[model samples]
Target: GYTVHTVLEYNYVLAVEVNGSVVGYVQTEQVFDSAREEVAQRINYAGAGEESWTVEPSYQIAVGEQVLNENQMADAILESSSSEIQSATGLYVNGELVAVTTEGDRLRQELDNMLAPYQNPDDPNLTVAFNKEVRCEDSIYFTSTLVPVDEIIGKLHGEEQGAVYYTIQSGDTPWTVAGSFGISVDELQAQNPDYDFNSNSGFPVGSQLTISQAMPYLQVKRTLVSTYQETIPYETEEQQDSTLPMGTVQVVQEGAEGLAEITQQQVFYGDSSTPSETTIIDRVVVQEPVKRIVAMGQYVPAENIAYLSDGSTLIWPVPAYRGISRWMLGAGGKIHGGVDIRANYGTEILASASGQVTVAGYHWSYGNYVVINHGNGYQTLYAHASSLAVRAGQTVAQGQVIAYVGSTGKSSGNHCHFEIRLNGARQQPRDFFPNK
Candidate 1:
C-alpha cells in the first residue's frame, strides 16, 4: 500500500527514488510562514510564473484500499518530491532596489546588522524601519543609501556659519563711505546701527576703511585758457619843411604780459622809410605792458588757438577776390562783414585765423567753402572758392593756404565772399582788425 512518509515544507513535496521505479513521497509544512508569505508576495510582485504540479498513485495500492504487503509496498510507495527552495535577498535605500546574491539570507543578515547601529528604537516618529535588504529572484540585493530629510532641507536653505566684519573710519559720511566701499548706506547702518556720522568722522588722514575697492579717477590732458596778441607797426607822420633827413624810428620794445609774454624783439625798416643817422631822442615804452594771461578753468579749458596768417593777425576768408570788392558795412549796404580784396581767377585762398576747421566742404549757395571755429564762439567763413585745401576738424594757422578763389556760388564774377561769426551768429570782421 502506498502511504505518505513525512511533510517537508509549505508548497514543497519530497520523494525518494529507488533502484528501478517505485518511490516514496512526503509533504513538508513551512515553519516560517510569515517569511514564506513575504517571499511569495515579492515573487508575485516580480511577475514570476507559477510552478507545474503532478499527481500519481502507486500501482500496488488497490482502489480506495490499503496496501497488502508492508515491506514490498514500502519499496513501491510514491516518492515525495521537493522543489529546490532558494532564499533571495535584495537591499533597498531611498526606494531604489539593489543587487541580489546567492547567499541571500547571509546578505540580509549583514544588512540588518549594518542598519542596527543607526536605528532609533525609541523613535516614535519613524513609521517604517529602514529596509536594507530584500529577497528577490532567489537572491539577495542591496539598495541605495537614504539621506535624512532634515539634512536635505538644511542644504536647500543654505545656512551661514561664518562671521563677517567691517571697519569704520574718519571723514566718512555713511552715504559716501558706503558708496566708496560698494555697499549700501542702509546696509552699513544696519550692520552698525550705533554708527554716527557726526561723531565718527571718516578719513582720519591715514586711517583705512574696509570697503569695496573702486576704479581711480582718470587724468586727462586739458587746455588751459588761450590768449592771442598781435603787434603791428604804427607810424605818426610829421608835416615839416625843415631840411632834416627823414629819420626812421625803430621799435625798441614789444611788450605783452600775462598769458602772452614778449619772448623776443626785432626792429626793421619800414617799406617807405630809409635808415638815417640821428641823435638820441628819447627811448620810452609807448604801449603799457599788454598782459595776456591764460588760466586753466573748469569750463572751456585752454586749447591751441588756430592762426589764419603767418606772423600776422589779418585773416581773410578767401585767398583772393575779384573786381575789388570793397569792405562795406553789413552785406552790400549792410555793416561790413569782411574786407573784400581784389584778385583774378584761381587765386590761392588762405585761412584768416588759427583755429579748428569746422566747415571745410561746401554750402548751398556759398559753393566750395571753409569755416574755421577759433575757440570761444569765434569763427570765420570763406565762400566762392573753387577748391578746398583743408578738411573739417583740421588745425590751421593764420595765412595758411586753404583754397582757391573763383565765381563758384552766387557770384557775378570770380571772387571770394568772407564773413565772421561769433557764437554761430554773423559778426563784422572789421571789428577785429586794427584801425588803419
Candidate 2:
C-alpha cells in the first residue's frame, strides 16, 4: 500500500521515539522549535525553588500520521529526550508519590521550615513529625506540574478542591459544628486554634468556621509524652452516727478529692479530621480518695456495700496465671471492660466469689465464657475459656474451678479475662485484690 504522507511534498517529519516507541511526529519546524523550548523550560528545574515537580507528566501523544500540537509535541520531546534533563526528587506522602522537585536541598529546607513552628521551647517534650508516611526518593520525573510553595503547602494539607468552610448560623456552636460535621470538638479546635473557644462570650455569629483545615502541608502529628497530675473523684461512704440529729447529715471529715500522677502519651494531628489517640502508660495515686462521712440520728441497719468484696474480698481467679496483661480502660483510653490475666492454655479458671452461674456460653468477644452473680449486686465474668466446668444457672463456690483458659474469640493469646461488676457497672478488679 502506498503511504499518503510519503507522496506529500513536505513529507520529511521529526519522528520522536522514547526507548523505541514513537510518541509523536513534528510536522513543522515552528512546532518542533516551540515543543523543544517548552520541554527545556519544563525539565530544567531547581529543587531549591517553589516549583515542585512531583510525579512524571502523563503524556497522550498520538504516534505517526497524526499532526502534533505544541503541548503534544512538547510531551513527545520530553518523553524522547529525558536523559539531557535534570532528575527530579519525588516527595511521597503516606506512601503515595505526590510531588517532585529538582531542588532537593531547597525542598528539604522548606519542609524543615514548615515544621519549625511546632517545636516547644518551654516544654522540650513537644515533638512534631509528619503524620503521614513521608519519604523522599531520587528518580527521573516527567512532572511539569510547576507551582509555588504555598500551593505545594496546600497539597500537603490535602487539596480537595481547595478548602471547605462552614458559616456560623444563629445557633451554631463548637458542639453543634461537631454534630453537623460528624467530627469531634477536639478536632475542630485543632483546626481553628485562632478562635477563642474558651471565651465567655464564645464565637460571635456569622463567623466563618474552617470545617476543613488548610494548615501546614506536612500533615503533622504533634506528640507530647508527659507526666501530669489529675484529680481523683472522691467516693462518698455513709455510716451510722448516733451523736448527730435524726434525719440530718453532717460532714464529719471534710471530703477532698485526691490527685494522681499520670504518665500519658498524647497525639494530635494537623490538617486532619481524624481523632487523636491517647494512651495511659502509667499512673500513681498522689493522694487517696476521702469519703464524706455523714451521721444520721435515725439508726438504720447499713447495707453491705462491700459484703461480696471488702476491698479485698474477691480471690485470685487464676492461681497459676502469670500476671495481668491488660487493665480496664487500658487500650488508648477505650473501655476494655475487663482485665486480662496471662495464663497457660487449659489452666483452671476458678470463681472469684461464690455465686450462681448466670451464663456459660460462647460469645463473639468472650468466646467460651462464664458469668457468676454473687446475689449482692456483684457479678464476676470469666472469658476466653476453652471449656466450662459449670453450666448456666448452676451453683458455684469461691475457688471452685469453673472454666479453663484459651485463646478464643477476640483474644490474642492463652489468657483468662476477668471482670467485676457492681450493680452492672464495670469496676477495676485490681481494687478487689489490693495485695496482689
lDDT of each: 0.46, 0.71
TM-score of structure candidate 2: 0.34
lDDT of prediction 2: 0.71
lDDT of 1 by residue, 1-436 (tens): 2234333223343332333343533332232232234334333333323223222332222122222232222223312222332333444334333333455455546545534543456753222232222332333111111233334223322322333444544554667767776888766655554444446343243444444323211111111121234343343333332232112122333335322223222111212122222233223343544433222111111121223333334443432234446654745435445556556777777666678997887677788888888775677778778788899989986556677877677666777777767666776544554331
Instruction: Give the per-residue lDDT of model 2 (tens digit) for 97-145.
Output: 5666676667777778767777677887778887667777555455454
Candidate 1 runs further than 4 Å off = 1-312, 317-323, 328-339, 434-436
Which regions of candidate 2 deviate over 4 angstroms? 1-88, 139-160, 165-219, 241-256, 264-282, 292-295, 298-436
> Model 2, poorest ten-residue lDDT window?
298-307
Give all TM-scores, in the order shown: 0.27, 0.34
Model 2: residue 13 alpha-carbon error in angstroms: 49
